[model samples]
Target: MLMRIILTALPFLSLATASKDTCEWPSWQDALTTCHGPPSTYTVKASNGKGLGLFSAHDLDVGEIVMRETPPLKISPPEIVKGSGYPMPAVTKLVRKEFDTLSSAVQDEIMSLTYHITSSKEATMDKLGIIFRTNAYNSGKDIGLFPKIARINHSCRPNASYYWSDKLNKRIVYATRKIKKGEEVYVSYIPLLLTQEGRQKLLDRYGFKCSCDACAQERAAQDVSDERRTTIQKAFADFEPQLTLEPPRTKKARQQARKNAKASLQLTELVHQEGLADYFAKAYRVAAISHARVKDWKVAAIWANKGYELKYIEDPDSPYTMEMHNLTSNFIANWESELQVGQ
Candidate 1:
């Protein structure tokens, strides 16, 4: 378990107090104590203009669950649009009513969230709307406000991935790679497959420029990265034709399928080398299926195990996980026995 640190002792207090509604802000200790959820493996530290970000307190292995918390404040767009949905004022009133219902401590914490204000002189309802838009996570149909997890910053090439787990009834954050002590944990706010330019555009709505390695590369380097990603996209599209339920009957067709699979793996590797690790499991899955298509169960088993291990970290109960497990087991059982017979 990692220990929690107070925010007041850190640098976020100046901004927390800068608002005209400073009185509404949580007290020094309240601000410090508010974002501290149950301990697991991270501690909060000042991230300059990015505010406070979660940092690993120890060396964490790939696929390890780093943090888990059920959000304290959750609001839905439907709730705001319940009556006279067209009128912003009516929706604003609904939001205010909901905010007023929370305990003073919770309300203070909610108000303390980093948000862009349209009008500083705007109504509290309007401010509430801005807060909800800025901080809310779209949990399928409903948007949830998670003060604690909101502090986690964004990275296009994030080291951590987050997903909502129904079994745990919490939003779980897991390390996607080995994260060293003092490394800041991050999650992608948007899909990772987008080009750097497209990603920056999406993140613009959040009022911060992304400084991720993928985004900060020199123009020549960025062009190379983009070209690699484009090749990966084309290779995956071409490989789709080879994934038939029935394996190719002709030797020529089987050779073509293997060629396509190898091409896809080659392209995927180039993409991964560009610091986009999100494609790693997808590439391994393609390799597993490609090898399995040719009855090369030994190679298939190795790829399947790699893919399954990665998928299991994010979703242990996923159907994909079960499929991978069954495929790996079948390959090992069949191939190991055949090897023994040959020996």
Candidate 2:
């Protein structure tokens, strides 16, 4: 059953890159062209109350790969000068090296599109850091890339989950839950389940005040979600000891662990449906580990594959996927052997 879900998801993942020829890339191009003065094939539209957002010109479904964009510029952390301080001579030298590497046309485009930070103490040095900080998406392995997806303003509860696909060499955002036409797709800039204080702090730091539906939910629902998540965390913490304990673990203990893990998995699904993809990966990981401990390789393989799939969406060719692939292979081999013995 778990294998079936993974297999089904592969097709959806492929759709992210489906030909724009059929879906109408011109509208997207026009939108990007209008917004940034670039003739790129991504469109910007009013995302209802969410301000400006990026969306497909054609219909996009769950798991479909969206546009893949390479960052116009790349900056390493060391290359960045901290605080509002002036760039040391060394920093200037590195910036020049990076600037010199780009083609003149690309250089012209970047300089044209660049926006400077107004208040940096080291105005020139801080400008670059601010841009990268706002624009760069971690493509796993500490690599950061830029894409139009970064333009989409965040919601406390987001409609979509963005992953960096290493295999496809693009950042892909998928719907954690179904979306309809004309909906403003959103991604969470911060963890969705954080306490209100934590959520507000993150929002302020990111330069946006979130007024998304989940953030606006009645106090009752919010409290319920908080309580459920707390319970899930406590159950997971409790189960960890038994996982390390020497067996002949009692049947009751094992059953209870599985039950708790299942509840957590269900809660994660609810959160996903509520537009929280950031938590989905962690929730799936817990369930996978619990299933493995119970010797349910099939379910373990499924959840393990889910984690890999989500990671792949964010970073294709990631170490995470490679490790999961190996685990899945081992599980399948073991399953085959067990089948033979039963026969």
Candidate 3:
């Protein structure tokens, strides 16, 4: 059985020195002890105009583990509060219930995370709720708050990526590309397979416009970025099209599988051109499965190894990485049998 790291309760100091009435500017240092991982490879400070942003302390190689943390605050989606008729409140009633359990200092820490409030009336009603809505990361069935990780800002072409790791019971951030020392660390807050305009609309909710590579392109370059992203979206549809349990016994069926394997390889190249480092694993998985469908075990296993390398860096303890690990390591025999058949 896989071991899970339980999130133990944090003992917070009293906020007797500050006003508990309203959330003031937050400092991630307030939750310092809760942070786990390497010794300060990042510096959290004010970004140009984007609030607080994290920066790499030294040159970081691709696949370096940037940071890791077990969220101090983790709870089920507040919408689970069933009796409400409305779709949901900004923070849901869970905010009040959870907030009351924390020390005044932690309560203030939660409140100081985000500035988004639907209205002053709502803020007065539940300030913690507003902050919760603004900063929570949707981790599977639950929502969690990782104060320091939240300091990493958004970029349409982010150099790093993060995901909640159920296997390790923590959140891990990894550099998807080489990052220069002192450069701001970024991760996409929205899906990146969208046109510049489409991404802007989604980012508006975060109260900032993205100026990453895709969004910062010149007019002509912007057109090309949109076209590339659009193509990627279309290509992904056939990335792993359905196949039968056994390799196509019919000539035409076998031809179709061959075409699929070829398309998967082509999409891999396109994804690289688009610079979606975080998506490299998915692209490789598609190729691995597609090649296996054609009974090309050698090529399929190679693709699986490629995916394992990247995912191992991105999320070492994630189920996806574990799957790749099994496919390439000790359990390769069983994995080969599982992929030995397809239409």
lDDT for 280 in candidate 3 is 82
Least accurate stretch of 10 residues (summed lDDT) in model 1? Answer: 1-10
Local distance difference test scores for all models: 0.68, 0.56, 0.70
Q: Model 3: which ten-residue window has the lowest total lDDT? A: 1-10
lDDT of 2 by residue, 100-173 (tens): 78788866544433233444554656444454455566664444535366666677666577665555455555
lDDT of 3 by residue, 41-73 (tens): 799889887877899987777766678876777
Residue-wise C-alpha lDDT for candidate 1, range 151-239, written one tens digit per residue: 89998778888777655556777788789889999888887666778778888878888887777889998887677767777776776
Error of 1 at 56 (Å): 1.6
RMSD of each: 13.0, 7.3, 11.9
Q: Which candidate number would show the highest lDDT if scored against the true structure?
A: 3
Q: Estimate each model's TM-score.
A: 0.77, 0.66, 0.77
Model 2 worst lDDT window (10 residues): 28-37
For candidate 3, the per-residue lDDT at 130 reads 61
